[model samples]
Target: MSFKITDNTKVYIAGCGGMLGESVYQTFTDTKCTVKATDINLTAPWLSYADVSDYSEISKDIKSFAPDLIINLAALTDLEYCEKNQEQTWLYNALGPENIGLIANELDVPVVYISTAGIVDGKQDVYNDFDEVNPLSIYAKAKYHGEVFTQNHVRKFFVFRAGWMMGGGPGKDKKFVNKIYKQLKSGQKELFVVDDKLGTPTYTKSFAKGILEVVQSGLYGVYNQVCNGDCSRFDVAKEFVRLLGLEKDVKVTKVDSDYFKAEYFAPRPFSEKLVNLKLNARGLNVMPDWQEALEDYSKVFIEDLA
Candidate 1:
């Protein structure tokens, strides 16, 4: 049965303070659902403390809420950090979902787990929803474990694997777009971006909306919920600069991954590009094209510059 997200519906969201969390929070809140959003950071007034790694802490909080739905958005996304802190990464990215899966089983409610495109090694040009994942890094391995855990333990679960995420604007965007904008803001005339990397740009707002739609449909399973198309990192940066009307002011230089091997020491796939095969087959893909999403998202950064 499809669980409707009405005003009275109660949702317990863990790790609701990141770039993606901001959009998820707003999207659900706008629907007037009763939400208990939590994060250790407490970046927003709507967010409270919840360490997802500690099952005891999060289980207590979630059980108290007695939510009809559980969305585990918590993840340690930094590749380098995850590589260095293997144990912590496992706790957050792997065991965290295990905790949520346990609680969801207890409550018998649906759960939403966000996975990543980074899980696949770049041997394939593009990945579908059912591709065999060869996780290359500690972060990817941990996230893949979480995905598998959710599938195995939870009866009704939506594991949405996102691509290169782009949302939350300047204040919250911690991914590629924000990184490029920060360099531009810092008065860098030329931006060196790696063209070797390839992936879909998943807009947070669109992804959040897709989650709501899919969950409401009650078609519960793993889905590749990324934007309609894909591109390389250099393609994204060049388009982003053009969107900001800074094509003349700033120059985007294309380079390979080796250019910043020391800084980005963590193992990354040559291509993280994902195709929304399942979502499209189901007729639930609501994500805009990469360029369209980028243009709309750039307005926030442009305003910040003013």
Candidate 2:
């Protein structure tokens, strides 16, 4: 029994103001699904107000919409900020899911929870869908806690773990791609990139599309959803510079994680590379290769550059 997201389907999305949420909102609305997207930061007109950490407020909004599905895209993702604010991190990353799960359970509807590849400790070269997750940082611990809660408590749920998310372009991309681009855009001739940290680059467009496709199958379980391949921070930076046609102008220098240790002091895995084994085996994987996705994604930044 698959849960189909038809034209009549109503989706209640929380934290719908981030990079991934932008794509997810577009994807779902394109399908003619009734989407009630909410977030604390109402950047777009289509979005309303709702804080995922606030149980009563978020519950009121979802219940009012009476959505057939609930998608929680909310999380305190800043590693350093999370390290400094453990209480807030736990509230949003952990308890938030529990709140949504309880509501979904009451509504007897399916729920979608977006998770992170950073939950793993980076001990291995790559992680599969069922790999042992040893969360290293406050962010990872809180996120992993949410993942576990959804798996154990939620009756009907789809937990998709995304890797190094790249989307939302210049305005919304808070991840690696935007950070590198900002440096390049600032007329910096030399770019210092880390060669140690490695992960699959999950494009938000592909990831959102993957979510829609996976949910349609009605397969309710946790899946390691990432791009086709993996690379280090250095690989991503070099590639982005080339894509922006700045290879000649900008020099990408490879450095170890120690280079940014003072700034990014949070504990991060050496490898957050996730293999979409489950999604592939189930024939539900729709993620493009990291390079291909990056090339397409570069157009946004290129346009911004011009």
Candidate 3:
């Protein structure tokens, strides 16, 4: 599978406001691929505002841009929010990708869809590309729909399933790691984390680079794109405190999911680690370990706090 994308090749990125979308946009730009970024809320010079649910809106943009590859990175990823607002979640997560797939199919162009490892039943120790999906929440179910729709609708598509994304974006991060950092930086001396819930944390920039490698290779299918190691919320919080040189004595306590029953009522998978077998088999490198990725990511904010 040999593919070549030059500076003249146009690549359009949908959902350019989120962390993953921002990283994808930057990666393509760095690679010298002619890029056009689009999102519903166009805040940056590179972004064009368009709602993906409106077929006319997305189709018009696709037709006008005439890109060789379209990367659909827009998704409604708030698990609890999805549980509360099922209709909006499905519309944004499932229907949005369906519309993108339809447009890409009509134009006979490939689409790179960013999916999530959350689709797998977290009961399993780890999941691979071929693992059965047992989504525990509306958010995961919606993302799974996007994955299925993409595969069925488009002849050439790459579904990259990423886990607990970190890094990139401007104040858009709400993952566990970022939350821990915020709490600690706010001068909280104690933190309570669930020791049972487990998954790999992915750095957006590294994940974006892996996706580009797959695109350049022209090997299209579902692939797990995540850091090399897995950890629980407790593990991540501990690492966050350690890296910041915060007091090791800053009392970190372990609790069960039941502790936050009111705040997090949505059913969550206990573990959602995804193995990057496909990338490895193809001789393509996956992202670095979550610990290493976090260390690099902390550099951006560590100085600001100090």
Tens digit of per-residue lDDT, candidate 2, span 1-306 = 888888899999999999999999999999999999998888799999898888899888899999999999999889999999999999999999999999999999999998899989999999999999999999999998998999999999999999999999999999999999998888999999999999999999999999999989998999999999899989999999999999999888989989899999999999999999999999998999999999999999999999
Distance from true location, Cα of 140 in model 1, Å? 0.4
Over 39-76, each residue of candidate 3 has an lDDT whose tens digit, in order, gives: 98765777879888888988998889999999998877
- Under the 3 Å rule for N, CA and C atoms, how many clashes does model 2 have? 0
On TM-score, the stronger of 1 and 3 is 1
The residue pairs that clash in candidate 1, if any, are none
Question: Backbone clashes per model, in order?
Answer: 0, 0, 0
Predicted candidate 1 versus true structure: per-residue lDDT over 125-196, tens digit per residue:
999999999999999999999999999989889999999999989998888899999999999999999999
**How does residue 52 of candidate 1 score in lDDT?**
90
Please report how far candidate 3 places residue 292 from its true position, in Å: 0.9
What C-alpha lDDT, on a 0 to 100 scale, does residue 72 get in candidate 2? 96
The parts of candidate 2 lying over 4 Å away from their true place are: none
